[model samples]
Target: MEAEACKKCGYTEFKKGKLGNGYVNLMPINSFFSSGSPMIVTFCGHCGEVSSVSVEKPRKF
Candidate 1:
């Protein structure tokens, strides 16, 4: 969605970075964990605004 125009500044380009899988939280102190899929980092090259898109698709009704 924001790949074309930046949601912050309307830039037509972005920088993409890879994220990891073990993206879960193993902190026992917080007692929270995530066993979900991977994700991507998309940021506006011009305005430095960032957004995330998950590899998993949205659930259907």
Candidate 2:
């Protein structure tokens, strides 16, 4: 896939970050006991704009 430019700054450089904590996670709807997935965050390096947020394991959700 082509790398997307930042909507706010049109920057081509981006970074990936993950969101996770021992007590918090992104779980599927109505799945109370399932082990959840960490969120993947994409952002523009130049302007610090968040481009997208997604789950690391989409099939799990």
Candidate 3:
């Protein structure tokens, strides 16, 4: 995902982190190692401005 420009300050930057994909202990299921999707949260580190960002899914070959 690409970082977005802040509307309030016109700053372009992003902070990264995983969003979801929790492990559940169920029968015949070992989803404990699944990796959650990542999100690129964009915000102005200086001015504290923020904006929502949408990105395309990663392609696999």
Candidate 4:
């Protein structure tokens, strides 16, 4: 991915991370039995500001 500035802190360095565990994936509303996708997180390394949060499989939701 290309480097982008953080919206909150104007930092140029960002880190990639995940937000969900084995049982904590993002699920669709009213769909309890469906398996969900892992949430991908992007944040600024300098100021610990979250830049974006997204899912690996958006069609799953």
Candidate 5:
């Protein structure tokens, strides 16, 4: 998904930030063992602002 506008600078263009991943920490002690999907981080090229959003839809607890 692409961001429509940057909240801070209203910039319409964004660049995909450094490759990032997502993980679930069901328990603090097992944080390292859990696995999940990748996360998308977008940066506003005009103002250096950034946004991190999960690519997957919300999940029920």
Candidate 6:
């Protein structure tokens, strides 16, 4: 995950969560075959500004 800076206030602090939270389970048998995963979307909480967003999936365990 990459950290982002706010455009307006230049603030840097963001939360990270799954793209589809609790929508489905992580398994190979199910229909959900996630070839490429999601990346961390960072935003400024104080100014409510979108600092930066990245979609680079991490290496599978």
For residues 1-61, what per-residue lDDT tens digits would candidate 4 score against the true structure?
Answer: 8668888888898899987786888999999777888899988999989888899888987
User: What are the lDDT figures for the candidates, one per model?
Assistant: 0.58, 0.87, 0.46, 0.87, 0.58, 0.54
Error of 4 at 9 (Å): 2.8
Off by over 4 Å in 2: 1-3
Candidate 2 backbone clash number? 0
Q: Show the lowest summed lDDT stretch of 10 residues, model 2.
A: 20-29
What does candidate 2's lDDT look like per residue over 1-61, in tens digits?
Answer: 9878999989999999989764577888998777888898999999989999998878876
**Per-residue C-alpha lDDT of model 6 across residues 1-56, encoded as one tens digit per residue:** 76556678876776554453434323233434555545456666787665555554
Q: For candidate 4, which ten residues in a row score worst on lDDT?
A: 2-11
lDDT of 1: 0.58
User: lDDT tens string, model 5, 1-61?
Assistant: 8759989989898887434334432223435544434455678889979865544422311
Check candidate 5 and list the clashing pairs: none
Off by over 4 Å in 6: 1-5, 10-14, 21-34, 58-61
- Of the pair 2 and 6, which is ahead by TM-score? 2
The predicted structure with the larger TM-score, 2 or 5, is: 2
User: Under the 3 Å rule for N, CA and C atoms, how many clashes does model 3 have?
Assistant: 0
Leading candidate by TM-score: 4
Candidate 3 weakest lDDT stretch, 10 residues: 20-29
Residue-level lDDT tens digits of model 1 in 1-61: 4347887888887887556546531223433443544456777778878866545422310
The weakest ten consecutive residues by lDDT in model 1 span 25-34
